[model samples]
Target: MELRIGNKFRLGRKIGSGAFGEIYLGTDVQSNEDVAIKFESVKTVHPQLAYESRIYRVLQSGNGIPNMKWYGKFSLKTVLMLADQMINRLEFIHSKSFLHRDIKPDNFLMSKAGKSDFGLARKYRDSSSYRHIPYRENKSLTGTPAYASLNTHLGIEQSRRDDVESLGYILMYFLKGSLPWKGLKAGNKKQKYDKISEKKVSTSIETLCEGHPIEFATYIHYCRSLRFDDKPDYAYLKRLFRDLFIREGFQFDFVFDWTVLKLPAITMPKPSTLCKCTLLILSTF
Candidate 1:
């Protein structure tokens, strides 16, 4: 269905969706430029568009942050460019005292190099007291199980460390077609989570990042080494990939692999070797 928002932006076909809303390819009537429109229902169990709108306001001036002209809306070695942009984006988010609890491939938009899907975002520090949220345990798992941090799987409260760690997994996923924990069998959901956690715990950084650049492993190691309340070295992480991009003699022309045709296929691990887990169900706040 074609709809116009306030007669300013014309919503076209839906290009993406999430648990809370749908996104459409839109065109700005004034500029005639293409844009994306995010729509949320009034009756959603957990309304987050308003909250996300607030986040967009807070992040409006930050680097790599998505532009939000109205309340409704929300790269690569392309790979290096994307990674660098995301770290810069996350760094700005952490600076604002909010934790983007959900970090996954789907939440990131490739065309704009911006972060989206803020439904699980939470304040890690009290606004008045400025005190960090106390570390806790036995918490329900948050975010996608596949990209979640090891500590997250163990039920530890997530902080900046968790977000950075999840990014490490994302980087590796981009480099390699899949993660090692892709294909494990279990009788039930509980058992499946246990297996995933175990695989993450048992898989060494070196093994996990084998055949890839050492910087990837180093990034993961640094993230895992942080204390629950420690501030992540965002600069260092970004530098890790930036340096790799430089060493590989890649130019910052902004042209990505996907933009080119006749590229070699990415080798994915056999189905029997890697596993994909289902998303963890979220509870309403």
Candidate 2:
């Protein structure tokens, strides 16, 4: 099925779907460029799509973030490059006084370009306010069970540290393809989450990163050590990955794991092409 949005986008085949909405591969009719279009029902759900659109608007000027090509939009090239770019994105989010409560592989949509789902994001406080947001317990689990921080499992209110810690898990998952708690079993969803949370708190970083890069362990340790109110040194975290890349003799090219597969060749747009923002002109359905 095909649906046209305004004069700019022509939605094509469905690419993805989730609890929030469906994603389609779209085309910019004017520019003839490929884009991803997400459609969510406003009747059945909260306005998460609109909220994510606002976040993209705030991030339009930031580096390493997916460009807001149109409303409710944004991929990375390599795993290292992806990690580096995401850290910068998180840094920008924190700078704006928000905590990305959900950080997982699914939320991080990777392609030639990158964008994040901010459905679970919440503002901790005003950016200008220096007062610390008190940590509270008995809060509901907010992020994916596998990638969530131990603090998240313990019912502690999340902060910037939690986001960084979740990123550490995501990076490890990318490298290893599976986490230690991937197959833990329980009678129900709550019990399964509890088991996964227990494993996260109990498992040593060394064991988690065993036979893999040591930098992964180090990154996780640093993120876990941060205090609830402490601001993360994004530069320090980025440097860890940079040093790892140097040691491995890899360049920050656009080539990724998927690029190695027998798939259609990707023709990357010029840097200038990305700078051209397409203003949103939504259609009345």
Candidate 3:
């Protein structure tokens, strides 16, 4: 079945698809502006749908995240129904008292302009990316293996940390151009996970992200720290990333505080500086 693509939204092309749904570029019928459309599906749920729904619904969206727009829930095609499932996941989880268990880059998208690099784009906006996932889409596990959290891996109940791990993975993938597990392949889940958990083995991540500018570079660093703990939580990750941001970012051009901050300044040579210079000359003589 085909979704109605209106003149208001001209579907330019198919950009990407997730496990739950497909994302499409649509234009505003009245204003003729670009918008994204996600198709979801609804099926009689007996199992995994609960997890997917729990994560989506429970996920607390603040900051710049786009609030979900739930359309009329209806049953649709299962073929390419990944998108359909995700909407159901989003709705169900939020209804329950849980945040999104999985928050990866694949789960979100941005306007074409915001999709560009931070330097190229007017601004870097991630939290606001649109999620055009399908209804009742999530089935398998509630999370992706690559970006899933330690709690998720250990088969713990869903929590905010799952989203944190996924978000960290997305941030790294976008800024650095690859997941920590981008290239390596494994015969089994255990082997693949060992590679991610021991990030020191992933040399490609360092090499590729090496020369990026400070802002993006800092983002990658934050991502590294996030993936370390097995049960990484968003609040913990947020605090860690926040401290790192203050210390490393351009927005933190702090002047050296001589006493409290305990930093030295070489503004003008003081009497001490002159005496030191003199001592050096005398010692050499």
- Which one is best on TM-score? 1
**What's model 3's TM-score?**
0.33
**TM-scores for all candidates?**
0.65, 0.64, 0.33
Question: Against the unseen true structure, what C-alpha lDDT does each candidate score?
Answer: 0.68, 0.66, 0.35
For residues 95-179, could you state the per-residue lDDT of candidate 2 as single tens digits?
8788889886555544333335678888877667656688899999997888889999999999999999999887666555457
lDDT of 3 by residue, 1-285 (tens): 112221122333445554434455554444555555443322212223334434535663755433332221211111012222223343333334335554543343221111111121111112445232222222334555666654455544443334444554444443333444544467887687666545534444456345433333443354445432233332433444445444433122222111111233423222221110000000000
Candidate 2: give the clashing pairs. Answer: 75-113, 75-114
- The order of the candidates by TM-score, greatest first, is 1, 2, 3
Off by over 4 Å in 1: 1-76, 261-285
Give the range where candidate 3 is weakest over 10 consecutive residues by summed lDDT.
276-285
lDDT assessment of candidate 1 = 0.68
lDDT of 2: 0.66
Per-model tally of clashing residue pairs? 6, 2, 38
lDDT top scorer: 1
lDDT winner, 1 or 2: 1
